[model samples]
Target: SCCPGWSATARSQLTATSASQVQAILLPQPP
Candidate 1:
């Protein structure tokens, strides 16, 4: 399990990936 801070990091990464759009193609989406 992750801590509360992990959510912030995940959100940031999500934002970055969403902006780049290529990350989803490079990596498989987690389930």
Candidate 2:
């Protein structure tokens, strides 16, 4: 039986992408 190991990698990539996007929009603006 093959386990779904790629899901972990995908999740990590998704998290990184989400974090970067959030920072790009929310962290670069001047207060």
Candidate 3:
């Protein structure tokens, strides 16, 4: 029973979180 707005919001959040995780993984660690 999910509406379009809720579905889009969930997808946006998911993508944002995934992109952030990938960026964190690829960034160099500071010594």
Candidate 4:
């Protein structure tokens, strides 16, 4: 249940354009 909900939320927020934006934001990190 928790995984389903979390995945749904993440998928919603990570739409195509937003996903790229998020990847860009994370790409410069030390990890």
Candidate 5:
């Protein structure tokens, strides 16, 4: 495969960012 490591690294980073964003939205919001 061509550029296998780069693609996987990018996907991992994207997933991590998405998870963090979701967590932030789900957390309680202050008044």
Candidate 6:
């Protein structure tokens, strides 16, 4: 499940930054 503000964060970050950065945030590497 995504975080509560995931959508908002995504929208803001997506426009403010690059899609690559957003993708990295959305699909994080497993530790």
Q: TM-score: which candidate is best?
A: 3
Measured by TM-score, how close is model 3 to the native structure?
Answer: 0.74
lDDT of 1 by residue, 1-31 (tens): 4599999999999999787777667776898
Off by over 4 Å in 4: 1-14, 29-31
**Whole-model lDDT per candidate:** 0.83, 0.87, 0.87, 0.77, 0.89, 0.80
Superposition TM-score, candidate 4 onto the true structure: 0.39
For residue 30, give model 3's deviation from the true position in Å.
4.3
Q: Which residue pairs does candidate 1 place in steric collision?
A: none
* TM-score of each model, in listed order: 0.55, 0.70, 0.74, 0.39, 0.73, 0.38
- Off-target runs (Cα >4 Å) in candidate 2 are 1-3, 29-31
What tens-digit string does per-residue lDDT give for candidate 4 at 1-31?
A: 6586898787787786787888789885575
Instruction: For candidate 2, write residues 1-31 as lDDT tens digits.
Output: 2558788888999999999999988888676
Best-fitting candidate, scored by lDDT: 5
TM-score of 1: 0.55
Which stretches of model 5 miss by more than 4 angstroms? 28-31
Candidate 5, clashing residue pairs?
none
> How much is the lDDT of residue 30 in candidate 5?
84
The segments of candidate 3 whose C-alpha lies over 4 angstroms from its true place after superposition are 29-31
Instruction: In candidate 3, list every pair of residues with a backbone clash.
Output: none
lDDT of 4: 0.77
Candidate 3 C-alpha lDDT tens digits along 1-31: 4587998899999999998999789985687
Minimal lDDT window, size 10, model 6: 14-23
Output the better candidate (3/4) by TM-score: 3
